[model samples]
Target: MSPDLLLNQENALPWTERLNFARDIARGMEYLHERNIYHRDLTSRNCLLRELPNNSRQAVVADFGLARVVQVEPNTQPDSPRKMSVVGSAYWMAPEMMRGEVYNKKVDVFSFGITLCEMIARVHADPDDLPRTNSFGLDVEHFRQKCEDCPPAFLQLAERCCDLDPSVRPWFSDIVSITTAIIQELDSAPNGKYDITSRGSSIRRRQ
Candidate 1:
């Protein structure tokens, strides 16, 4: 019953709407981390967006059925050696979760990377487009193009978010910093417009 499921129906949104949707999702996850809550389930289906009366957007993390409170005991192991439960969608699950290994908040970071990629894909492809088969199989070309007129810092931050090593992933605070910086730059850009032609040319060169 999440609002994301309701809003993200087939053929439901235009590309610009999808972009704003992804931004709000990133903000919601950042908020969760600010409160020290790890939303173990961060798939697209679990994010709900609410429209404010001021014509702005807000999002919330929903479906906490798989969420866990991260313990902060230094060098302490679970009292029972039982394997941690594996939950969440297969495509979005971090490698450690798939292996049933005990992990910390970084697992959620990994899943966020996947979610970011999925959101980027939705910006270019039809809603009915098939899911990608692998991480690298994502449409980096499309993303790079859309970001062509965007500040370079924004594209770099998005790439860093998808880094393979969880240890290297940016913390929520870092994400907030980068996102805020980029938003400022975007706001200051002429007409809040980007050069899609340059983006398309860049994609062609890469291909």
Candidate 2:
């Protein structure tokens, strides 16, 4: 299931399930980053999920049409490799990318943050529902407001992923680390369900 359809079908997923989704994505991104590949367009729509036997869905990172291979310079950090082309969905594009500045693999981290926002807020990152554009950019304040009721740790990870400065953003491995912890906590919880009460509209979950 695509995340948009998943959210539309169930309104909102439980926190544990959402954490699982994020962890899956983080692991996927981590794998790609390890190979010096960047999924330039890492959005909810690009991720696919396969249903499991026990009322669970396993996320698979798909849609690599916009993916690029980073050409690392000798003795340079992986994130230091720069690319000039401006590509990827606008809603999830990093701030540096929107500015048409040279960007690196960290841009994917930014997109992952936006995808995480979608899972938490049950909303797409694009406020205007417009297609990706170099002239367009995200409103971070609005996004943060939409993330109300989201776990603080996850929200903080989102903030770090979407940081304006590419150097300040964490690597995909770091994301996998944090999400792994969150997933473990959730799995150890009662019935793997967190006591999350919706803050706004009723969040209908799938049985």
Candidate 3:
């Protein structure tokens, strides 16, 4: 398999690089969710970035080796039976995953959350200087610092993606909404000084 283009560290890239990367990832995950597919093994290595016809970069979620078709039941038992193997990166796996419990689409959400944080950090951070953490792990303060001055809408979305409880976390459709909103805000304010309260209002409006 080819290496993830976004993870390449040949040189530094602009903030837009990171934003576009995140957007592509969200889109790919949205597609998977629509098909009731859950990529149990989501990591930076599994996401590959390719240039669009317009010369913009887009992310493609790959490596479906651990993916499974999950049913969205109204009520799923925590101890339900699972057919797939229990294998995934430690840092990106959800808490329930660590407990060896059966999970659903929410597991992908948890991994996507970690991937977002990593992409944000990679935009401007030196990999060597980053805190020593596993692939699916994150340093919240470090993420906040790297994204300092980023629109609150984006920050909140990242936080929501990494929320402890998968039940409360937004689905891929909601993630698309948040990411779209953030992109719109960024386009309007190129300087990146966003209205936190106003952005919060927009998010609440969606909810």
Candidate 4:
């Protein structure tokens, strides 16, 4: 498991770098889904970061243990199971998967959204670990959600990704576009500042 960003970076990465990591994961998911590949187990622990110069990190999606190809089988039955047995880490598991309902690549989108919370908070995505909502779903924009440490744009996209209805979740392709736009906006801004929680950053939330 990735205990923290960069595998073992003593200091927490800047907010922009964390956002870059999020983008890289989104691109990786887009690549897999484009070819009908389903990464059944998507989580921060499965994602590896290759350190680059100047504190930048390249996020690589690893651990394909539960990966499945959603290809049509010649002799498959119409109702054959497509990994509906509730696989993946419990924390990152999607609602459909948790309910043991038929699911698809959209499950990964849900995991991605939860992973965003992990990225922002540097904490586990388990329920009530951090400030959350009474709603049964992950809603970063919820009035009670304490995701203020994360970027508003990132939080908004994560909210969409975590929609309880799989059909409402955006595809990894759409996620790529949104992350690209966010990175662009960050770059174009004049000396932008962000809330960096913990790890001796400029912003720290005292308990």
Candidate 5:
């Protein structure tokens, strides 16, 4: 609760910097998944944003209260992360988790998709409308259309991440790759500089 704020429409990040939001969060989640940590509660309220120079921003994932470091059995498949308890914000939760099924890190991917949608849509999420089983078709399409600057691949990735079936979701590493590629492409594009500025601010480093 250190950041103590949720990203919402009133405080929505500038549209041009959305890619930074995607890349930074994806990178952080990739690190956690790489080390076998699952952040069960992944939401805008659990993410912190620090202003940076050149109108860029850094997003940090927080709130690990429901997080778990799955322990692998000697003979178990490496990809089969054991489920502990049904935990996580309902709106961002995967269908498997809602069903109380033992699942792997894909649940985080489902949450990531919801978070990404929030970033692009620039609105506070309502959990009641977010359960994975409810078919977020309308919500997803609305966000997709609203994100004029967002790449098609990015939107596609978000939808895939929120797939009802956990097994169908892509890995965090794959998310990192796609986000990184999109960021690079945007950075190299001449017309992509719209709304970006040199704010002369550096990230706040807490001791």
Candidate 6:
């Protein structure tokens, strides 16, 4: 098990760890998507961690029990992917998935958003609190009131991942670009360290 993944503690997760925790998963998912494979179950537990000597964790996406390979062109519908029962974890399900509508790989983006929320909160998620109905994704209000301690850009990425319109969600390729930018910015900061426990001072809203 990945110690870095354990969030049920007294202190906030180190800010860098948030990006570190998610970076590889995004990469792995991106790679899978490039090959037209999507993991239907994308919870945190599906990720395996390699603990480094320096205590940092390296994430590997695992458990392909419900995965599917669709060889179709972009923005073009593939064969039916609908299932009889609601698939995926309840807490991380996209709003469309929750409503039993058609879903696609963008569902993984939604799950990533909730998974990031769990990482920030340092506890198991409360499904009731996840975005619902027409209000999918974190708005500026959720950012200021609920996730002030998380990196604004990081949470912003999550927010974009959770957009109600999957068309609006960034691809895994974009997810990779965003995380790389965050790591670069933090690496250039004074002392090159971000205090995970500190509340975020500013947020870059998505335009």
Tens-place lDDT per residue, model 6, 142-204, is: 444566656668777877776778888888888888988997777665444453225323223
Which is superior by lDDT, 2 or 6?
2
1-207, model 4: which lDDT tens digit per residue? 377543344756666677788889999998998877789789988988887897556999999999877776689753244655578887788887887888788989989988887776666776756334444467554422554555677778877887888878898888888888877765654444543445523332334
Candidate 1 structure quality by residue, lDDT tens digits, 93-157: 76667677765666666666655555543331222342333443234454565444334564565
Q: After superposing candidate 4, which stretches have Cα over 4 Å from the reference?
A: 6-10, 53-55, 73-83, 130-136, 139-145, 191-207
Mark the regions of model 3 whose C-alpha exceeds 4 Å error after superposition: 1-12, 71-84, 123-142, 191-207
Clash count for each candidate, listed in order shown: 0, 1, 2, 0, 0, 2
- State the displacement of the C-alpha of residue 127, model 2, in Å, after optimal TM-score superposition: 2.0
- lDDT tens per residue, model 5, 45-119: 788888779665688888899988877688888678465799888767777787888889888888888877766
Model 3 lDDT per residue over 54-167, tens place: 986677889898887777566865324454557777666765676777666777887787777666544412234433234333456666776565556666776787766667
Clashes of 2: 1
Task: Tally clashing residue pairs in candidate 3.
Answer: 2
Lowest-sum lDDT 10-residue window in model 4: 198-207
lDDT for each residue of candidate 2 in 67-147, tens digit (9 for 90 to 100): 887778889876674757889897888878878888888889889877877777776566553223343434556665765
| Candidate 5 residue 32 C-alpha distance from true site, Å | 1.6
Q: What is the C-alpha lDDT of each candidate?
A: 0.55, 0.73, 0.64, 0.73, 0.68, 0.69
TM-score of each: 0.66, 0.80, 0.72, 0.79, 0.77, 0.78
Off by over 4 Å in 2: 1-12, 129-141, 187-194, 197-207
Better of 3 and 4 by lDDT: 4
How far does residue 155 in candidate 5 sit from its true spot (Å)?
A: 0.9
Of candidate 2, the 10-residue stretch with the lowest lDDT total is 197-206
